[model samples]
Target chain A: MRLVLLIFSFCDWLQRTPVASYMRASFWAFPLVESLHILCGNVPLLVATSILSARLAGWGLREVPVSKLARGLLPWAWTGFLIQVITGLLLFSSAAAKYASTRIFPLKMLLILLAGTNALIFMRTTYRRVAAWDTAEVPPLGARFAGVVSLLLWSSVLVMGRVLNSAVSLVVAAHLWFAR
Target chain B: MPDFLSWCQWLESTPMSATLRDSLWLFPAIETVHLFGIVALVGSTSILDLRLMGFTLAGTPVPKLARRVLPWAWLGFGIQAATGFFLFAAEASRVYLNPAFRFKMLMLVAAGLNALLFHVMTSRSAAQWEGRSTTPMSAKIAGLSSLALWFAIVIAGRMIAYFE
Candidate 1:
């Protein structure tokens, strides 16, 4: 597995992003909304990073606790997710007809799945108890664990998103270069 | 700019990146890891920053909160530095030629330097910071800059695909 991954990276590394090949610069909506998608997707990312980083540093959620902040931030994060999913789909639609065959596409979907499933688990199991944490004062093994997992999963998703996009861009550029 | 395209073609044809590109999935995988680190860096620091900026928790020492999140942020930076270069190496001249790419690199430098200034000039004293958590002006400036820079980087990164 490591060997295969290494080979792929090497190939990918050799391939440039071809950053300017097919850009029409004519469309407004696609670029506008893609900007939004990228922005919004970052919301959950920021919150999750904070909660988890707090844990990694031994602060746990006790200082802020979990239930309140999680609940408060949940809507914003979900809003971001919704934007990402919707806009992400549109962005994909712009290129979808051929993106299906790429390896990075599968990786992107899998990372999203990992993040979503893990997030669901977080919302369902540990978050329910967040309200009771400050007063109840539990040691936070569960929330800590959840936060750590959230960080790891989200991070993977972020990387996958980038790699997927980069690889896809490379493929598109290659196609254009060849067609030219 | 035809010269630039020729340069990219030449760069891609070279045995160095070709061998590495064909041989190293480690680059992407580490990049994957770096993404996680970056999210953590943003997430961890923002939580504290938000608190300092009057968003999340109230009444905690600002310095203490900063202390807690700071290490994680640094760790995130470390991971980012490692994998970020590989992402660049995959296509340096390509990114190097784009305006958006240049801006992103500038933002990266600005963000890093801003972070340093915040720590050096504006960090709250240990006494005022740890318990009642009042963020110094410099820290807030750093946080806002950091936020803007990272977001810009992400946008530019995404825009790299769309750039002409």
Candidate 2:
């Protein structure tokens, strides 16, 4: 109850921010920034994840050391994530109330949380043992499972993000129809 | 040009396009799949491009890296080509008129050409540079050019959604 209130208040606060309002009102700026967000944020992370996931599944670039590959790519993923968070927040703030109310929105967040958690667990456990299978073509079962989950979760996130607008419109239309 | 626009308009009016546009969920749903295609295509391509640029992943041979990622890249391209056509069919005339769409098409051509040329020229001599972190001048330039062009395409793609 208290926690839910705090969350709602935080969302309200975010919605009221100047950046949020600006994003909502500006036509060109919104789209341009959204494009930048995808380029700088999602693209890199997708690239890193695809490669890492592929490597983990023992499919691609079998010759490269897994630890080295992770080291090389994960930084780009982190950088993309940071950019994504900022851009995503700005986009969300543009219609915080609608987003906050949407079922898909929470689902999207949950999927993201799950993806992050999976990555964390993998890093702490299977990844810590990465040195053992650094040169092996196929990673251990745990690592492979993490890879598969990461791909599915992130892909679902992309799907959810895209459909969010339509979902909102549908909800609004339903409410208006019922009210009438 | 007017005929072409009419043709596009006709395409947009088709049952398929109508269904896509009219459904509350369909257009955005296709768009979501389109995005996944973009990720797969661009993500896979970038892996090879990065290897060419010698940015990272030096331990792996260049040819090997290319071999591994290119298939997925091709798969991504196929998905994008299909999904993109569907999206375009739904809004054909409008996209035809959109400067962003035009720019995106141009960039797509450029990116394709870059890849073709790299395969023909720079990648022909990949054997010499396989194990090394840094590629030859031509390969490096090809890689860098590809990255820039693809990034431009993504920017242009995003712009299309807004400008149209």
Candidate 3:
């Protein structure tokens, strides 16, 4: 498709950038940036969002109002997400074409998009009525559904991210095995 | 040190460890569980830490919040310990040689000790200040230290592969 070609061209451009070249050239840069990505972005984002989801599902933290928990925690979730976007982009730029071609990368991105859409729909619908059962031990069915779905989606995204890393190693291992 | 090295070697030869190392799917599967375990563990701990620091959910008493969150943290801890042992067993000899792995172990001990100390010292007096929006200075210090140590642990854990 023309769109796919366009996207690949964009990836090619990104991969050719000076920053991308530096990321590939430097030994410490990739790992250090990756450590930062996991620590700052993935960890906090998953934690905050998981806690929020848990609360929505009536799994824990029953005393705190949902709104209060969301208010306190959503900021952290957003902050983590912001960091994820920045770090993810930086990492992607280094091997844009390869990442674009990878199945796992697209899968991870799709999971993220679905997670975001789930949150958006929840906020627009069930969450609009949060006041009704904000402190209830069991939130409405819709909120709980959203919560469970979000948890599974986000966790899958995490797994896929890890899988993406391992997939590369697997390829290298296969190459080595062939070489041997 | 020699005794430890031999122990690691023995672990590496065990049937369980051999299975984990040989299987393509098993290692990644367990590692994925380990990742989720971290979410539960660090996620619960951070919630409590944030509350203790008067950052969030101040309206809820500390004891009440602890009652709600600590179980999940313990569950997460149990998962981590179990999965971590398997992971260590799979590559015990090599991991023992890894500086990052060694550092992670030290950080884990320190983090555990920090938590134990908080429970013994600061948390005993939690009842007195549980209602206040601002926690005692000691509690804040404990929370801050736990957060820092856990983040360090995660970073160190990630660096294990890089080091190897």
Best by lDDT: 3
lDDT by residue for model 3 (A19-66), tens:
999998987777777877777787789988888898888898787789
Give the TM-score of each candidate.
0.65, 0.87, 0.90
Clashing pairs in 3: none
* Residue-wise C-alpha lDDT for candidate 1, range B22-136, written one tens digit per residue: 7546556755565566566666666665775665556656676677678877887787776766566667677678787788788888877876776676444555565554565
Off by over 4 Å in 3: A172-180
Q: How do the residues A49-161 of candidate 2 rate in per-residue lDDT, one tens digit apiece?
A: 87799899887879889998888889999998899898888888887878888889989999999999999999999999887999989899998899899988888887788
Model 1, span A81-161: residue lDDT tens: 778888776666555534555776777778778767776786687666655564444435666676666676665566667
Q: Each model's number of backbone clashes?
A: 25, 0, 0
Q: What share of the true interface contacts does candidate 1 keep?
A: 0.41
Query: TM-score: which is higher, 2 or 3?
Result: 3
lDDT for residue A165 in candidate 3, whole number 0-100 = 72
Better of 1 and 2 by TM-score: 2
Please tell me how candidate 1 rates in CAPRI terms. acceptable
Error of 2 at B92 (Å): 1.5
* Candidate 1 residue runs with Cα over 4 Å from true position: A1-39, A46-69, A99-171, A174-178, B1-16, B22-31, B124-126, B133-142, B160-164
Ranking by lDDT: 3, 2, 1
